[model samples]
Target: MAEKEEYVKLIGSWASPFSRRVEMALKLKGVPYDYSDEDYLVTKSPLLLQLNPIYKKVPVFVHKGKVLLESHLILEYIDQTWTRNPILPQDPYGKAMARFWAKFVDEQVTLIGFRSLVKSEEIDVAIKEAQELITYLEKEITGKMFFGGETIGFLDIVVGSMIPFCLVRGWEGMGIDMIPKEKFPELNRWIEKIKEIEIVRECIPNREKNIEHMMKIVGRIKAASKTA
Candidate 1:
């Protein structure tokens, strides 16, 4: 643990992929802070509601009384504030490309992929869509060590958070193989490479644990639908 700095705080949920991304960035940068785990259901703190009225969600960062909402936005703030190790590239084109892929993950992979998980009937089409997205990533990252190359940059963190969750849920919900070595050799290789990083390996949630949680969530949804 780094020396406790002047009261940096993160309000997030335990299993949120968004929260995990921020946490991983903080850990990687050796930022010392306090973490408050928020409940998505039942209750949300007044402070949380105030900071993020729009989303009314967790994964909010408060640094020295200034609040930041959204995981990607928070990540950019963190990198810019701390000059120690910049997460994004200095080159304009590189930065633009990074931003583009990050947006792709947020728009397509996270939103669409997660929606597909909760409704199993949509799994087949979702799997196909996700494969096409993965194919784009596989093509984009032909010879890079990280998504941003050597040093894992903004895009890496953004996209990396989704991979494990997507893998587990896609397999469990749809019984589809997304990262087969034979089909996506580059992607499979990259997945293995990213996991080798200490920050990623230590912070990423356990795949089995996530699958169990998702199963419980699915069961509840199914029960509610039957009753309705």
Candidate 2:
């Protein structure tokens, strides 16, 4: 085993894509770190609350006692600090594009995908809107093995993290095919390829378990909507 250099710890939940993203980056970069499993659905850990009082969310990364919240930001920090296996692109333009797509994955894909489930009444409209956004990604990934080109990088990690929940099983569990294989051949192929990666296979939650968890989330969202 390699000698530990600095104190590194990650507060995260196994089922959370955001948490998985950070873990994937760490593993890809060969950075050994301690993991604190914070299953927020059941209870938020006191340590997580203390570290990220504002969001009180999982995937709060701690390096040498310095705390960092937000999965995307933590990914960048890991890439910049580790410097061995670069996650983000080296050139300015490539880095900007990576950041742009990563933001799109979080803000657009995640929101719209969840909205489809929350507004089950407007399922058709939501599915259409989601298809439109996925079209952009389909076009972007044309002839490429990944969003980051040959190797998985910033955009890949950001988008790949959501594939199970946002594009596949989570949606499928709700009887929605967010990314139909016929409609998104390239994207679907990319999904298959990414899933084969050792790090990704290790980090992804079990399909049956994730589906059960997603159903609970959908039920809660529906209940909240009814109250509202």
Give model 2's TM-score versus the native structure.
0.95
What is the C-alpha lDDT profile of model 1 across 26-82, one tens digit per residue?
A: 988888879988867558999888988998998989887788888889998998888
Q: Cα lDDT of model 2 overall?
A: 0.86
> lDDT of each prediction vs. the true structure?
0.78, 0.86
Candidate 2 differs from the real structure by a C-alpha RMSD in angstroms, to one decimal, of 1.8
Give the top-scoring candidate (lDDT): 2
Q: TM-score of every model? A: 0.87, 0.95
> 217, model 1: CA deviation in Å?
4.5
Cα lDDT, model 1, residue 30: 87
Lowest summed lDDT across 10 adjacent residues in model 1 is found at: 165-174
Q: Write the per-residue lDDT of candidate 2 for residues 1-228, one digit (tens) a residue.
A: 224448789988878989999999999998888998976878987888888999888889988779999988899999999999798999999999999988998899888888887785778999999889999999999999988989988888888888654346668787888888899999989989998999988898888888888888888888988899
Q: Which stretches of candidate 1 lie over 4 Å from their true place?
A: 1-5, 216-228
